[model samples]
Target chain A: MSNTATDSSETTARHNEKMKRIKAARDKMMAGKTEEKGLIIVHTGTGKGKSSSGFGMIMRCIAWGMPCAVVQFIKGTWETGEKRLLQAHFAGECRFFVSGEGFTWETQDRDRDVAAARNGWEIAKQQILDPRIRFVLLDEINIALRYDYLDIDEVVDFLLTQKPPMTHVCLTGRNARPELIEAADLVTEMSLLKHPFRDGVKAQKGVEF
Target chain B: MSNTATDSSETTARHNEKMKRIKAARDKMMAGKTEEKGLIIVHTGTGKGKSSSGFGMIMRCIAWGMPCAVVQFIKGTWETGEKRLLQAHFAGECRFFVSGEGFTWETQDRDRDVAAARNGWEIAKQQILDPRIRFVLLDEINIALRYDYLDIDEVVDFLLTQKPPMTHVCLTGRNARPELIEAADLVTEMSLLKHPFRDGVKAQKGVEF
Candidate 1:
């Protein structure tokens, strides 16, 4: 037999042994996990896909024929492609509440921003309590919390106490509070590696919006 | 006048002034960016939403009536919720090529894995060059690259040289190569903050799969 063939066979055998060990470990690890409940998922940090991932979850929910609600806290200035598409496809099934005036810098007045956040939170809270809404997306609620427009304590308290047991809530934005993170069942922090905006590229119509 | 009324008026005036300044800055910034081209986006890291975010981009492309393709490289062990959902909605518009045998540990054969990766890459390259495919997702391709099942140099070269100018390509997985990162237009690392698996929660039906 050739030396190359012998070496290849040896490697294959070793790899097979390693895989056996891995499968055993993974099976043991997975066997311990049997619980299922509604998740408080937070997508935060300085990355591009916080809102995008939240929308993906909504799509998954929609595919399962679950009624979903989206409460936009700081993205009401311009119309989004998602809003237009979801409205066209899921008119009665999906309820969208765009309560924010605009971004904080765009709005300029902290008072108005506060009022908008409060209004958005009211809708979000109502959605959370509604058993009909299987998933509630508090879109960009982290920004409102970061700016202190909405009280973190109250938000955390509601998440802990008032939400229906079967409704999943997703909060998306940068700089998610530690308190919210503590309360979340799953938290993903999107780390910015490279962005096209830094390279003088404008956001395209369907890509960004 | 009452204190509340005076404060409200001052706040509105200040907000309007701030919005004007913001519009000027944003307009000026946007004016400088006039170039448009296809983007090579990478979603990597140890988080859970890497593939979910790529699917979000696919959703965006679908909204624009663009034809898209999904070539899953390492997630073919079981039926995924996304595959079922997207296939049902996008019927003839989207093409899904699930070329993976399974995870490495499950397959336990290096030679088979390499062959699967090669087959998947051929389809990926062909789809990437197709004008009809506006968006192509190489889902979990990074895992194939990391394991050396697929040649990173060949993948990087194809991405750099052969991609259609207006066709966006999204690569999703953990541990994306530095070369791929350098070639990508946008790269976002999904940082793992907290996962339900660690808290004795198995992957749920509609949420994880």
Candidate 2:
């Protein structure tokens, strides 16, 4: 028992020493990261949580009393949990625009899709430029871009140049345009290692929405 | 002029037909997904937004009027935007716990780290088993598990067997144990494609925190 205790003690000391070194390195690294600027953030890939993340950031923004806007390019009239929250709870605080009534299901009009995309883009442009809004989430605008409904160069140019210095814009969807990715300050690809839908499990409430 | 109109009409018709076929396939596929169960969700990768995604999910849970709990296992006592939000806005609605005071810099006590992990685990157990708490987030618990501060099998067994049927648990961090991933119903790997930190931009407030 005494030997076992001694052995554990020695292990603890080694672990402590190792941890100290890591902490030192991390602190030094953190010290160098001193500059801050508005970031063009992108969340993309064939996985869940792309839009969920953008929605989450809005909560962070709300927590900080920062004015944020969400422009839903695809899930237009779909009763999303976030939409309900924004409507019922944060109506005055956050600006929300549901531009697309939804794709293909409601109408197979490509022109209509294009028009909705443009409408969403218009709102996004205003929010991105508006210094009042610190953060703007362009939810699923990438899908519209993917289908060639919006001009990639125009959107990228506007986001890169016209966006206010401290205002951040997050675009979430799959197949984010290469131009946007190249222009973004931060890009996260949420890839699906596994999804319940693949195993025939239906989407659940408050989780999928 | 007549030829141009005819060509445009034909293009629109083709697009409509294509969209219809795609929608039909999706509806058929969705029809097979009929079962629902509380999910074991894992957000793990070498990227940002793992915790951000978890934070976002909490907002969704709150929006749905569900009482959720967030047990922060790593960022103990650190001021996070979510923690502030929970305290300031959703105090009663969400239970927030920060377990780790942080690693190494504060204290070089391995035993203390282990104890903190256990302490956090104790809270996690109660929250996971509590039916009132519909959702629980084990933020950065994977790091504790990675350091062997908590037994993986023990943690996994408790999460799998002891968790309430309808309650959901989310584990977030880098390098999640394969056992947890294997058991997870939904796993999204948030990979870093680009980060401003690489360009020497500091972690900004509201966005990072």
Indicate which candidate wins on lDDT.
2
lDDT of 2: 0.87
Worst 10 residues of 1 chain B by lDDT: B1-10
List TM-scores of chain B, every candidate: 0.92, 0.93
- Candidate 2 is graded, for docking, as medium
Residue clash pairs of candidate 1: none
Per-residue C-alpha lDDT of model 1 across residues A4-91, encoded as one tens digit per residue: 9889789778877898899889989999999877889999989888888887777777777788999999999767767776877777
Off by over 4 Å in 1: A1-3, B1-24
Recovered native contacts, candidate 1: 0.62
DockQ of all candidates, in order? Answer: 0.57, 0.69
Proportion of native contacts kept per candidate:
0.62, 0.70
- Give the distance in Å from residue A138's predicted Cα in candidate 1 to where it truly belongs: 1.1
lDDT of 2 at B14: 88
